[model samples]
Target: MKVTEKTKISELIKHSPETIEVIASVNSHFNKLRNPILRKLLASRVTLKEAAKIGKCELSVLIEKLKPLGFEFEIDMYEDSSNEKINEVIPNQIFDSLDVRPILNQGQDPFQMIMSKVNILPLGKTLEIISPFQPIPLIRILEQKNHTCICNEKEGIFSLFITKNSNEGLENNVLEKKIINKIDSFDEFQNKISTFEKENKLERLDVRGLEMPLPMVTILEKLEYMPKEFALFVHHFQIPQFLLPELEKRNFFMDYFIVEEKEIHLLIYN
Candidate 1:
């Protein structure tokens, strides 16, 4: 049968008792059915929209539950060149008008203080933010809590913030090494972040002052290797909503604890 909009694969299976044979035949050539969940969904004989909803819902729940632990979760939305659709859906201008001073002025808050001095710029049509480590005291506090912390720099001046959870004992030497190691060449740093995520050893990796192509490329790579049992703590400056769809296309996944200055959002992807 010709696959058309009105025809539901799930319905086809339900109507055909030999559906399993057909599915097996197709799966033999393409391994998509190797995934039990996907196989089950296909076997259910549901509409393609229903199957997609199942996948989206599963991912959403996973991301939500991972929020408290600090994960960077997102949905990927797509659009065309008119810029009208993208702007209407995921407005890039929000960062240009974002306020940070108030968040920074919040008394004795570490996340707030760190975000205050950061600057987010537009890279192409995408938004980017850099939050560097400005307050030494706050760094010490996070380190004392046994978490991994990162500070970014542009022209030797601090500019971005990213962190990961850690259990290592904090000595200045250890903390310094962790931060320093995260600064391998921009490419290396990005690769290392993915490796850390894959290995579940990622303790807060922050990228700053890197040029175009680097951020977008790394973001794509990061999504590909997103860990199932890790949380990402990020201080949002200006990031894109389309990142999620980009990741979805590649089957990328991640959960996030995104602190935009002070307001916190938790994201989980199952």
Candidate 2:
């Protein structure tokens, strides 16, 4: 018989009694009249309180709404909550026993170094140099030597705060601002000239960045071309201990040495 909008469900069942008989037989054994997929779809449509009932008014309203949407469904009214109980219990146990392991020593450490030197070549009143990145530890050392380190990462300019030899300690508090104003802009910093002579040469050279080239090696190399008396080589955790022998073969001079910043232990290079 052709299924139509006007077709009565009871009339169709009467005409095909075997279909009802098969469903009734299955229901007798399983106590489930509707498929699980259809039950879930109905659960989403009907209110929770109405979904729990076999033939609730809200369920009838949902079924009416679903009919036009190509779904002809019925509720499977079973009293068992065993499946939900099992689902809730198993998840916690499964997650608690999960194994997630991490690999060890898979790559070289970026901050690996045996020993390094800070060549604080004085430029009369201030220092001029280029570095791979911000040399914070070296700046601290310069500060200890009564020099203020003003670093501008954006313009790639560094200046040391200095005062007249006699008035050095007196102007310590205003040193940072003094050095900052000197390199206020990239144009000012690039044009400014250093007048530190050999006898009172205060330009510090840190060739450590040259020893261990950073990701910005091209920039460092370009800066190396510019004429500057004393440059600083700020060494960090990048220079490897194993490469120190090969580095020494290249005749690199070392002055002030520190094993690490936190620990003030000086490293003796053979």
Candidate 3:
């Protein structure tokens, strides 16, 4: 099969099972692909372009590795100008800055803190995130919300600048409300689930025991082929911060019941 930087790792593996080993050899980070579950979860969400970033390797390296396996390259990887653009700076008015290193040091998730700032972000104003490494998943999630992001790395530190586009209609308060609705009350959550169940249009999925990103991946894959009239009932471990913006992008509304600190039930519907 023809391959490009945009080609998904899953597609490459499906084209040639040997790709699993070949990709794993690229970097220690990719060795997780040796696990069937990790491969299924990660490969689907990542492309060769993202793999290169996540693995901290060059795209040409991946292309070269797969070339021996008869995979056709879509572009001249050696001369690709895309890498030059990775460091291009887009000037944005910085309104707020968040350093997540301390949060990570405390063994805490900074997603909530990041999203809180993102939700109230003013148009044409940028939110700067300081991190030890590129937060690719967080970048992807915010980009799905129509936010523009430019990331630059220096000395193993990544500075990501994100701004909401004025043309995306983010200035509309109604649209903002529609984009971030969280039903947290147990009574309200139960009522919504009961209503969906009674209509016989509730589809069930359990992503409780899955690892990070797997739960998000599983939920997104299920939603892709979900019937429009039906709602998805998801048994999850926590409110998936990364998944929330994606659902909002797809115009899906969500409600959740916090059964415990680690057990949560979500009702997602259009």
Per-residue alpha-carbon lDDT of candidate 2 for residues 1-270, written as tens digits (9 for 90 to 100):
543322433343445543333333322321222333222222223232222233322334434443443434544435434345434434432211111111102222222210011122223333333343344333433455554444322233222222112223332222222111112343332223222333343333233333322312322332344244433233333223222322243223222233443211111111
**Of models 2 and 3, which has the larger lDDT?**
3
What TM-score fits each model? 0.22, 0.18, 0.57
- lDDT per prediction? 0.36, 0.30, 0.76
Q: In model 1, where is the ten-residue run with the lowest total lDDT?
A: 175-184
Model 3 residue runs over 4 Å out of place are 35-45, 78-87, 92-95, 133-136, 150-156, 166-240, 243-270
Q: Indicate which candidate wins on TM-score.
A: 3
lDDT of 3 by residue, 1-270 (tens): 888778899999998999999989988977877876456546876788778777778888888898998998886556545446543433437889999898766444578788778778787778889988666678766665688877766567878888866444332232344644566688887888888899898899998776555677788888888899899999987777667656776889887777877687888999
lDDT of 1 at 68: 41
Per-candidate total of colliding backbone pairs: 23, 19, 0
List pairs with backbone clashes in candidate 3.
none
Model 1 segments more than 4 A misplaced: 1-203, 226-228, 231-236, 251-270
Instruction: Please give the lDDT score for candidate 3.
Output: 0.76
Q: Would you list the rank order by lDDT, best first?
A: 3, 1, 2
